[model samples]
Target: MSNSLELPSYLEKSAAVSERFKKLHRRPVKLKVEDLSKKFETPKGELVALNQINLEIHRREFITVIGPSGCGKTTLIRILAGLDFPTSGKVKLEGKKMEGPGAERGMVFQDYTLFPWLSVKKNVMFGLEIKGLGSQKAEAEAMEWLEIVGLAKFAEAYPGQLSGGMKQRVAIARSLANRPEILFLDEPFGALDAQTRASMQAYLLKIWQNVDVTVLFVTHDLDEAVYLSDRILVLRANPGEIDELIEVPVPRPRDPGQFLTPEFLATKKRLEELIRPPELAQNEEIPMIRLTEVGDEVE
Candidate 1:
């Protein structure tokens, strides 16, 4: 069995308890996105990045955002993380309108944003230290998160010494140690190779199970979206709009072999259909007229 099964019993409690937790998490609507739209004005005209994205992410749920390259997945995540602003609509966290970056929201980018100068422990502790948690407390919290992500042994190692996967583990630990209610991951594993990417996906699922954080993950891989998401949000380009939201019915503690199963294949096929172009899989990519890179709307 995988280490996912080695977790403490509490993570494998009754389905009833899980249902109750889901209800509790969904009740307050941990994160609410309504009528969210973002556009960038350019010399030719306005470039619409995201259009009318409405979503409700429950607490502690793992939500994956999927679409083609220019479908506004990254743009939407940036807005949700408060790193960028939406041109129209609002996002609320715990019923409070989110304005700018705060400790309550943490982000892990595709690039290893770890401080090359700082040791893994220090990198994880840096955020807490900035929030004035002090050296002693920050170290303790950082260690805990590092351990949660299975990087405690490498605490003293520098970022340059770690592999791509280990670097990403440290990044996740750094974000999670802050105890943020919402964690936004922007293709954090996109840089890894196939083998490492698969391993990291399972590692992330294990870590997410252990933590009390809600996740909004953006990915270009259909298999990844199907494997990790509780509910996958599919978007289409050309003004980047929501196409559909699909639920994955596979049970928890899924392993790599599960991918070969019929249910998993079915889900993956459905997702492929959602994002694939007809010229290839379904339909042609919607043409974006005057949608050049000059707008900085990020396609």
Candidate 2:
């Protein structure tokens, strides 16, 4: 027979008080961003991707930027990663101006961007090698990160031998090997099947919990955004600007199962409405020709 046991009332209350005190003492982090803007001048004309945008992304925070396909969500992230330059305004790290891409910032592009010829380990070490790190040290760090992303067993496998999801995992491990202060994910799960995408999201959350880096993820999937972020930034198309900033109140060490909750669904619905296109109202007639396409307004 098993003895039934329960915590004494005083001990339980003490534990609860301790948890509350810890929460109260914790300070919120602040990210400083100011009047961030960007534009692209092609042969057709000058296209404004972002216009006078200002945002603050907290440290160790997870932020998802979502909007219509043509919105400047990608452009904003590119600038943040230092992959592209803003037309005007500024972006900074701890209030210092960002000069260019460095080890402090790492990016995972839409495409897996892995080298087919190289084995997983080699691909993950590509950056370190270019930065002049010794082979032995680079290999050790690369292998550790590969294991973190659950890809260590495939170290000798080439990109062509792995599935899309596995390849993306390699990409993530590679990006994180640099130990960047900020991780920029540009639709990293876009190419995977639904099942694989969900799996990757879970894997990502696990990795995130162990790392203290801030994550700026761009995605069109509202469900994914709600599941992964501390806050969501909704952007609007046509001279892209942040339309709404939604703070996810859900507690973390979040499980993928949380998506089934009413709270999560409600947040997703609200974000969907906020990002819905204003030009096409509920009963509006469809236009045969999308004139804006000719102007190259969409990316």
TM-score per prediction, in order, is: 0.85, 0.82
lDDT of 1 by residue, 1-299 (tens): 13322222212435654675566455557899999999999899999999999999887788899998999999999999999999999999988999999889999999989999999999999989999997998999899988888889999999999999999999999998888999999999999999999999999998888777889999998889878887789999978999988766556676877776565666776777678876545457876677455776645
Best-matching candidate per lDDT: 1
Please report, in order, the local distance difference test score of every candidate based on alpha carbons: 0.86, 0.82
Query: What local lDDT score does residue 252 receive in model 2, on the 0 to 100 scale?
Result: 74
C-alpha RMSD (angstroms) for model 1:
10.9
TM-score (C-alpha, index-matched) for candidate 1: 0.85
Q: Which ten residues in a row have the lowest lDDT in candidate 1?
A: 1-10
- Please count the clashing residue pairs in each candidate, in the order shown: 4, 0
By TM-score, the best candidate is 1
lDDT of model 1 at position 87:
97
lDDT of 2 by residue, 115-217 (tens): 8899999999988987899999999999999989988999999999899999999999988887787899999999889999999999999999898778999
> Deviation in angstroms for 268 in model 2?
0.7
